[model samples]
Target: RVRAYVPYGKQWYPYFMRRLAERPANVAFLLRNLLRS
Candidate 1:
């Protein structure tokens, strides 16, 4: 349900904020990927 909603690299702060809010459970894992880009 969540992976479908993740933002691609081109998306910036707003995208990160939205996804984080939408899935706090995955914040750490998602943040790791975000930083890797």
Candidate 2:
């Protein structure tokens, strides 16, 4: 399980993108949970 706190603002997208880029596994984890819901 992974958790994060991202302030909602103009910088949010870039911040999330950087995180996803840093770890491709994050993308897979996200998709897995999203589809499970």
Candidate 3:
């Protein structure tokens, strides 16, 4: 079993991006989103 907790607030996206920037795999995910936009 696995569980995750998510936080909700106005600042969530920046904080989330900061976290994703720390990992290489997540960088690809982030770039894909940027290109899509």
Candidate 4:
């Protein structure tokens, strides 16, 4: 699972997490900005 990978000791895990974590926020932010524009 993605959640499990985020906690384990892996080189790329944290990178994936940041990307994954920010993705939804970014999408929501974009949609709101798009509607305003």
What TM-score would every model get versus the actual structure?
0.39, 0.77, 0.51, 0.38
Q: lDDT of each prediction vs. the true structure?
A: 0.76, 0.91, 0.83, 0.68
**In TM-score terms, which candidate is top?**
2
Rank order (by lDDT, best first): 2, 3, 1, 4
In angstroms, how far off is 20's CA in candidate 4?
7.5
Better of 3 and 4 by TM-score: 3
Q: Which candidate model has the greater lDDT, 2 or 3?
A: 2
For candidate 1, lDDT tens digit of each residue in 1-37? 4555445676677887886789877888867889999
Over 4 Å off, model 3: 28-37
What would the per-residue lDDT of candidate 2 be over residues 1-37, giving only the tens digit for each residue? 9997866888988898888999999999999999999
Q: Candidate 1 lDDT (Cα, whole model)?
A: 0.76
User: Per-residue alpha-carbon lDDT of model 4 for 1-37, expressed as tens digits?
Assistant: 3554234456577775577587788767757999998
Q: Is candidate 1 or candidate 3 better by lDDT?
A: 3
Clashing pairs in 3: none
**How should the candidates be ordered by TM-score, best one leading?**
2, 3, 1, 4
